[model samples]
Target: MLMSPTVRSGTLVMLIALLRSPATTVAVPPPSSVQASAIGADVTAGKHLFERHCAVCHGIEGKGGRGPGLNRAQLAHAPDDTALKSVISDGISPDMPAGWFLTDEDVANLAAYVRSFSNIPSEPLPGDAVRGAGVYAKGGCSNCHIVAGAGFGYGPELSNIGIRRSAPYIRKAIVKPGATMPEGFLLVEAITPSGDKIEGIRVNEDTFSIQIKDATGQFHSLRKQDLKELQKLRGESPMPSYGGVFNTSELDDLVAYLASLRGKQ
Candidate 1:
């Protein structure tokens, strides 16, 4: 693959990894909107909109989830700021439904947040996205994580994980499930009145009831009175550490494929 000529090869590989690094820089696409890119425009407002409206499918930080990540070298349908506004206002076909509900100001603010992704320093990497996809299928990540909206909702969706996390972070997460836990995933153990034992991911719970989903996608809902045990193991997750599961090359390939998934169908 032809590496981007903009940066040194080594730096490019590390570009997406150092999103917050001062040295890391993404080429800001030429701004087409004077109003949207205005300094007075509230970047914070845009971030809020993204977190509220777009985070479900696009990811918390424009990283991607069910939708393609906005943090990318280039956009698929729109590139310039003005075009981005149209994308936000009109929404696109196939997958990206329109957001006609947003006000003009909301569109302006959201555009700023989307534009910010261009400067996040995601150039490219050595790992291959296609082969990495095969790795994902083989690794059984879909059993827990969702990609392109097809998987058990038990685990965090990985459609936009590449943009949400860096290559090294992704690698570290695979080998260390306990290191960080996504927002809602909490390990739980439930024992029935008959002394039947169950351990799986805690899906949801209420004062009177609890729900958990196992690896097989079987959901077990237990009332608080019936269960012999229910424990919320904080700082814990059901995802197993892949340290011994994959070799170094396989890990790299998997990471590459995951990073390439920016919500594209």
Candidate 2:
């Protein structure tokens, strides 16, 4: 019962095609119990690592304090697992110090733990965003903070602050500005050779020269050698604490308004 030459060639071609097709491959099942156990262990280890190394800045629950919240479904800088791992290892420059002591495995575990935070729901804002905008204007917040190309550039920009910082962190900042003075906004007081004292946030500095932006929004580049006195006020913030100014409701409203500023969204 030999097939015709044409039929034989067609059959051979079909057989080869079948052999090369992905449909012929076996489907892999989900991870086995042992593999699942290993992953669970990794996540547990990562949790411990986060508590020890990251909890101080990121908050004990990863809700955020000095750093951005990890509990959100998405992070601006770390949109995926790979980016999260890299950020944990390399850090984000002057704002976030690199995890120099962490090993590859440690970083993986830490990322897993941080990723777990996404499951936790974001906290709800207590105040009205509309009222908060009024509070912001009344408090003259724009004088120090910038939002969407408006306001001064003196303090940290709030254009995307809603996505970057948690509401609690923003509230804490408003109530106690000195608690976390941010990375770049270092307060400095310099005395000129002619007995003139100038105080401002340190814009930039080197061994020979220092640049300062005074409260009056003036830029002063002074030579270190010519200054009679140069005082670096570490852990000090030029932004005044608004604890006394804003009542409880006003404070809540302001926090809500700032948290609503997601920028271009």
Candidate 3:
């Protein structure tokens, strides 16, 4: 393996130890030097442990996916081993899924792995935003969309969209927009006195009735209890398919441009 000259000797040793005996149980020495040595050892162990367990979901560098970006300030001051163990064991609420599957040792190593992200700088997306700007303009993306705080208000703004969504999700959104429809585009239904049902994307609602936008952009207003079946289905986007819209290279470039938006703080 081509090792970086900057890698501390202690870190390299730890890497070798991990590669040699990944399953071996060992006591982690407490930080005593209060210097670069401790940081290097922890980071090296973290790198290997992360590669073994978290790389698939969080990327090799922990950028994100099935998990949030660990490098971000959101987790900067998260508690130490005890607190981290709970989080790793119980997990954060809402958006984050449970992490109870991890063993105590796994959690410990994983916490150290997460801490490594804080030391390394995030790699920027390798693409020309300038080129992406042209592609965005000529590709007719703004016809019903927006980018970087500008463009039509009909579609949700794409500014900083790269941060909230992953590259794969973004690609999926563009290629098959109908798959993961955004919120607010959900179809709502109401029952009528005659036992009839009507449904469409609810644009507005009051105690008595609701306004809806259908596939054709046509709006319909209906009164409450005027029909049967009132279900909110945020399924399928109305955006057109982008298959063969651009060559593979263009797609790659577009993704790179989007990824580049994940800037460092």
Candidate 4:
């Protein structure tokens, strides 16, 4: 039936109002199987890339070896997806080199694969954390290491060692300190023109000057020309082997104590 112009306009207005109302329902389509497959393929490709480029340092399963572990839900440096991608592309200085060869899509896929490691369950620790604390105290570990700003700063700050290192890695480190003498902790001996020998960890070095922090936590800045001798004790670590210091159970307890120290949060 034919309607007047005013009646038709009123009907159209009512229809528009109804569509805009809260009661209105709209169906959104789920992602297609093909799209899902593409995503899966990207992740697979990323895993391959990681194996080729990152596995040397990060391990086959991202459990870590020379570099820090990526199996946890959170990464200290790369907290979010965007940050993760940036790290993969740019890399951390001194220790980690940048992925200058990776394309943008390659970086995305690598990030995806790294993120997948977070879903895997963390390995359970066996030692009692409380007992481990006592073991640590008895071992004189605070003489060199620092935890949550409590101990000496001669060694690396271990506030986030739990997140950075795996249980096996920590165990090995405790038993054989020389095996995993952290990067950048190079020992050196310098003999000045005055015939005084100073031995310590090399803090920083440049073209003109070198800095050293001795066993007593003293800093020495010397010019390269003024020194009679500057010897880099490569493949040597001042941190002694504790293999004979602690029994098996005590070692396990120490590992647990160190593992439980997952930063402020």
Which candidate achieves the best lDDT against the true structure?
2
Q: Which one wins on TM-score?
A: 2
Better of 1 and 4 by TM-score: 4
**Candidates arranged by TM-score, highest first:** 2, 4, 1, 3
TM-score of 3: 0.51
- Residues 56-165 of candidate 2 have per-residue lDDT tens digits of 88898898877878897767777766688789999986767899999988987787678777767878878999999999989998998888888998888899888666
Candidate 4 TM-score to native: 0.80
lDDT tens digits by residue: candidate 1, 94-185 = 34668889998899778866877765665466777788888888988887889988876667788877545556567777899888565566
How much does candidate 1 score in TM-score? 0.58
Q: Scored by CA lDDT, what does every candidate get?
A: 0.72, 0.79, 0.59, 0.78
Between 3 and 4, whose lDDT is larger? 4
Ten-residue stretch with the least lDDT total in model 3: 32-41
lDDT value, residue 79 of candidate 1: 59
**Per-residue lDDT for 1-265 in model 3, tens only?**
2134387877677764664374632444464322222332344555676786667656777877534456653452254545655766675543344566666556665675676565556556555666766677777877666666667644555665565556666667677777745544555666656675655567888888788765445677877666455666556454677767976667766766665554331
Q: What TM-score would every model get versus the actual structure?
A: 0.58, 0.80, 0.51, 0.80
Candidates sorted on lDDT, descending:
2, 4, 1, 3
